[model samples]
Target: MLTKQDVHVLRTLLQEYAHAASLPVNQEKQRLWIKLNHLHMERPMVLIDQIPWNEMDVDGSLRCLVADTYWRQVEDNLRCTLYKFRHMPADMVLNPYVCLPRPIHNSGWGIEPVSSRHIELEMGSTAPSREFVNQIQSLDDVERIKIPQLTLDEKREAQIIQEADEIFSGIIDYRLTGLCMHLGIWDSIAMWMGVENCYFALMDEPEMIHALLEKMTEGLIDMIGQMNRQKLFDIHSHVCHCSQTFLEDMPKENDLPLSGNAWAFGLAQLFTSVSPAITDEFEVQYMKRVFPYFGAIYYGCCDRLDDRMHVIEKLPKIRKLSCSPWSEREHFAQVMPRYCVMSNKPNPAFLASGKLDEQLIRDDIRRTIDAAKAHNRNLELILKDISTVNHNPSCLWRWQEIAMEEVQR
Candidate 1:
């Protein structure tokens, strides 16, 4: 089922990544190559000789070009990795497009203008489940989209984030970073109505919550479909991005687990900044309606995950899951076991904490290994954003020890 052109594209991509892996021009590129190599070694069967990878242009001029370039390389390598896992020898990778919240990335949440009346009315709408209906509706009624009125700082804040985001457009995978897009209506609702009000509305006014999710999810699905057609959905490679924990707490009316549509179900669980209670609610109710649209589910993102792990055990279509810094390592090792592959990330504290010694970091990895062993031996270590590491490359070596030690055991 492989074609010469497809295979050639992949080989070129792999070679580029291989080159980038050794040559680190900047911090972002270095991280990208290192991560690619880690994946290649951890899942050699899926990445090394099995799947096809291709290189492409890294868009965005304002951000770190090196990081963007390196990610492009990794994206190509991951294509091959995904192909081997899916048993599709030459198919291009089609992942979901995730728009996450702001808080997950340590970027504080800000208020976006929205209409309570319009949102309330949309909640009771009887429209078909077509995607982007809200956008269409919003466009049709621009007046409804008007903000109640924001303070000067709110406007400036929103603008600042927008400008800064453009700079790091492709560098930070915000979709996976925070779970969902920051500019969407529900996001506005959360910031404007306050999480407490919006949450209570989920139960007190079911129609309102239903309308909000339907509208928001529709926009997301449309975006994903467009990206899929354009072959740009690989940006947010992970399905659940940052929403796995939030899905657990979603109201029974909202929890939507992935349905088995090989193409559509490939990605689910993209909500972010969501709590355990909300994650369950969405998993039990809402996601049920939407899950059939993806091929697989990638769960977990930046979340307060202590309460969410128990719920992950029940998701039926999940093929891969991310292990957040906050999640209990042993819990994942005990729960999903072989059903899912775990991406283990050492907390920022470990790398950012000025106390950078092998013993301290080694203890942390030792604990992680001891915990993951209870489930299965599979694991991948991810050394994410370490501003401090920028000054001290030696700290990275400790990470190598941690990973290698775990493998040796």
Candidate 2:
């Protein structure tokens, strides 16, 4: 239980953050981003790394149901503060709201859950990777996989919103909205069958692989239909993980936002090792089945899409493409400028080196900026997939300093 004093402290901190977010400077910067996203004009924008909360020194004393609510608000405020102080081009908004009917109960593809164990190499690591035991062994197992029916618990959802409102009514606004589904086809299949097994299945059992992909695609389409039927699609106009670009077409107050008004993301990180042809056949073709359901698409993650640019070009709604660290920067500068927003993902490994190198950081940012300028591309730098900062928060602060310096130049 949170003491009255605890609530007072939290409410005070939240109000201060909300006030900062409401400033005109932040609002204009966000509008600039929206314009750049819609291809109305070209400009550079940056989203500082989405740092993991466990990486920071946050107080963990709050407990129970209140603790859950308290921590969520606290973390957002803290990160927003960090971004402002570092001069990173991240947007700040008045309220921190989340959509409901998250669709957690339904595991669309009916595959046996894989067993996994987390192995942490060091203390304060960003997040641990799991060692998985693959559950699907043969083609027959694919038949057993069935798509589960989705059901929304309205009463429980209302109770959650009520409790949150009571706690944060005057401090900050609480909105019950909808969110887009981030459904990855290749990643799910690789999770069921081992990565190696998935590769062999492509050649040894091409027919079987196609059948499994078809089934998974069907399940995802059905899940999307369910979400639409339940009125769970909400407009995400703020800075979100769904896309690096901002939404140009947001629904009006009286209108219900559909998936077409929001950004949808699709990735095939596991398909990195596969040939472009195989990736196009197995991943891109299946993804196309679901991509049209959204207003716009954000494609790629950690994977390099250099060879498969042609395949990606086929997606009519793709508005942003991830230019990962592994991608050829020069090549992408030439290809991506004419197409979509170049969502450049800088390598986060520098943070784990235990020492901050200002020169190295500057040079890295300079190279990316130079390449983007030469091609006239709309760029957004996103620093993600960080595992550690070696307990030095200053490294991220320095990185933002260097990145903004380069952007201004």
Residue-by-residue lDDT tens digits, candidate 1, 47-98: 1121001111123211211233324343443443333323321112222222
**Which 10 successive residues of model 2 have the least lDDT summed?**
57-66
Model 2 quality (TM-score): 0.87
Error of 1 at 127 (Å): 39
Candidate 2 ranges with C-alpha deviation above 4 Å: 1-10, 40-42, 58-65, 68-104, 112-117, 240-244
Candidates in order, TM-scores: namely 0.47, 0.87
Candidate 1 — worst ten consecutive residues by lDDT sum?
44-53
183, model 2: CA deviation in Å? 2.4
| lDDT, candidate 1, at 87 | 36
By TM-score, the best candidate is: 2
Residue-level lDDT of model 2, residues 65-140, one tens digit each, is: 2255534554455444544433434433332433232323465556654647667866545577665566665678
